[model samples]
Target chain A: MKSSEWPLVIFSLAIQLSAGIMVIYDLFILFPMYRSRVAFPSKYHWILLIALGAALVGVIFSFLHLGNPTNAPRSLSNIGTSWLSREITGVLIYSALLMGTTILHFVMPSAGRSLKWLVDLTALTGVILIFIMSKIYMIPARPAWNSVFTPLGFYMAAIVMGASLLLLFQINHGSWASQKSLAILTISIPVIQLAILPIYMSWLGHPDFAGGKGLAILLHNHLIAFYLRLVLYLLAIAFGFWAFFTIRSDTTQNRLLFAPALLAWASILAAQIVDRLLFYTQNISPEGF
Target chain B: MSTFGFFCDTSACSGCKTCQVSCKDKNDLDAGIRFRRVYEVVGANWNKTDEGAWEHDIVAYNLSIGCNHCENPACVKACPTKAMHAELDGMILIDPNKCIGCRYCEWACPYGAPQYNKLKGIMQKCDFCRDYVLEGKPPACVSSCPMRVLEFGPISQLIEKHGDNRSVYPLPDPSITRPALFIRKHPGAKLAKKLNASIINREEVKE
Candidate 1:
């Protein structure tokens, strides 16, 4: 199916950003401090609870796009023919698994070596969940969303945005290592994005992409918008590459990398919003009936 | 058994969107929500080519789409919730209450007919307006198309009316989703065949 409208994309992005922020807050902010042998109020329990709760809220927020919210359960019925159903099922399963792992982490944090192994396993599962989320949009039937790079592109975009926001939080919290961490992720993400952007755009500009009605709409009666989108994506790629190439070896002690990487990260975020907006706005839904 | 089908004549279609409006009206659908939509496709972006010569050969193509009621509906097989079902009469219907807003059908459907109502927490799509059809009436979209681009009847009848010419592209030749629709062969098809023969001849000469 075609992507949702701009308003819906903006709303979903807002929720996703919020949920992502909270997730980062709990993982990067709270967890590190808890592990640092510093005195913290209450236990990590409260943070875990909050993170899970916020994720649940995010899940609920996702429901806002449904036409028949009441029939949420039946979405699973069409798995044989639908990717969305698989995504929903995957999300539910992943959420449940995450919740379970969160509880286990809280209730029995003393699993020692086994705990490390479990955490690694759970992280892999989270990665898989993210991949599945990307797959939800990668249907070949919709040429715009069908390319091999789509899932990877979306994942990189999410990670770029997510990691950028996380670094932003860390920087705000006065973490000296934020720059180092930010530099590393920023460099990698853009490199990945640069490699993927061409493929993604090629798919978008494919000789056969007659279905990107949203792009066609945005490009309607004018070529400027198309060029503008092109420039935005190119700029995003350039900034990412610049940040990657200009990586300072002294990042563990320097501030310059932080500024540029932060800017690059912000640019990437902006690029994503534009990309997502175009994605939603450019679709020509099969004349809906 | 009933095999529902649609007949669209691009030459006659004025791109009025009557099919879209009628589908929405009959389904009692919400605004900003479409069960059928009409698209206008303009021809080649010649300037993008290196030749710097742009040829604007825009053709007006109007498509009124809904559930194709396919023989091998990808939406049905992929649905984890079992929300969509094809009846004996070859109509695919979604039970809104049963849909969990998963949006699987949306992805599975090449036609992009299954819609997710975020507020309702379920999926909804055109049931061929089967509610009226059962009562011996045509679907709102079929009856509403002023240009008569959207016609519904038995699959066999549609095949006879317009055989194997429903889309500019071959309509996913593998038929993975088994979408049931037809394309009208335009003059472009004839031109393409001519071009293809010349290209093959050129390749043979080069070889």
Candidate 2:
């Protein structure tokens, strides 16, 4: 691919990442905050709306990667037989549900638990949309994407990436951690991601599914992507271990732990982006990879 | 009165992609946007047979595809904005203004015809060159194909003209989407009745 294609590739990766990550935020972070009675931070709502906006922007930007702009609506006509069509319909429905819930929750705060059901419904809808999106790429005809494990990996990777992004934002805002205890929780997220990485890769590289274009991207694509993933995984494990050990120690400086924690988080973000790019590039469809 | 359709003769299609090129030119398509594409379906093994006896039973078929203009188009139903519409002539179209940069249609199309424009923040697709059709001329793709493999007219007339050739096969069958485009297989390549019966039985058993 030329340098011209890089922007489009990055944009596409962002869209895939946002679709997965933003849904988790809606389900885990934002909705939970609203459901709880404890006063935490008003910033959460602003952050979520921003995330939702970003997700929409990400989706729109990815369209620039397509060959044509005018004929895009024709995609809707084939939903009866196409997974892509289902994904489109699902995304639209979820977006409507989310928008409705968001408006009602913020604009009409007195709506109370009635809006909770709407949130619940939106969350459920988002989950189904994400699943459909994953399946769109998981056609059995394409050996590279045929595995059941790929979709789960995508969902998990989204959470890992999204949480890390939100984590960074929280850290910068100084609202994420007041003491070392909160820092420990932040560190654990990447650690879980590190553990999940190997399991997902093992599933992806199973003997029955190994050696296709998709497998090859992860296994042998470029020296850079492979090395980047390795470094990211190692950083995640190392910092996770260090945070667990040093977070409790009085002598350990917060700055020392914070730096590596941020680095490990960044590395995971990079790895997931690389993985998503490889996913699209390795697809040997009728258009060729 | 204007349910448009395509009758493609696989026996005559040489995979020149004239139809594909014409569709692109007619629509002023962006780079890499193809409304029609030809596919070759290579069937049975030939390398295993002896050289003299090795008659390659390759039923190479060219698929000139655009919107199927189905009675129930998945794309139209999926569009939240109702930007995609099925015309009375059975042509599927999209109004770019109403498309909110959402790509629901892209995912909806099994044949991958709709191309999303990031610049305009909308979707676009072939309109069957309705201008030419209104002027009593065939669509650009139909006229441009050098091999004359593509025949476009009213759905009923075209079906009546060549439906009984016993070589044509429409895509995805009726159950999946009921796509209007028809595919004609090469002559002498049709499955024998006994072979077809056995194949149907095997499929039935597997199902």
lDDT of each candidate versus the true structure:
0.57, 0.57
Poorly placed runs, candidate 2 (over 4 Å): A1-151, A162-227, A249-255, A282-289, B16-33, B39-63, B71-74, B77-80, B99-107, B115-124, B135-137, B144-148, B156-175, B187-207
lDDT of 2 by residue, B59-151 (tens): 434545665566556566656556777776678888766665555566455555566665566677767788998999988889998988888
TM-scores of the models, in the given order?
0.65, 0.62
Error of 2 at B203 (Å): 35
Off by over 4 Å in 1: A1-57, A73-81, A103-107, A158-182, A211-275, A282-289, B9-66, B77-80, B100-108, B112-125, B129-152, B157-176, B182-207
Native-referenced DockQ of model 1: 0.33
Q: Of the candidates shown, which would achieve the greatest DockQ relative to the real structure?
A: 1
lDDT of 1 at A202: 54
Weakest 10 consecutive residues, lDDT, candidate 1 chain B?
B198-207
Per-residue CA lDDT of model 1 for A47-139, tens digit only, reads 345445645665776676655566666555545555566666666765675577567767677644444444445445555655665666666
Positional deviation of residue B118's Cα in model 1 after best superposition, in angstroms: 9.0
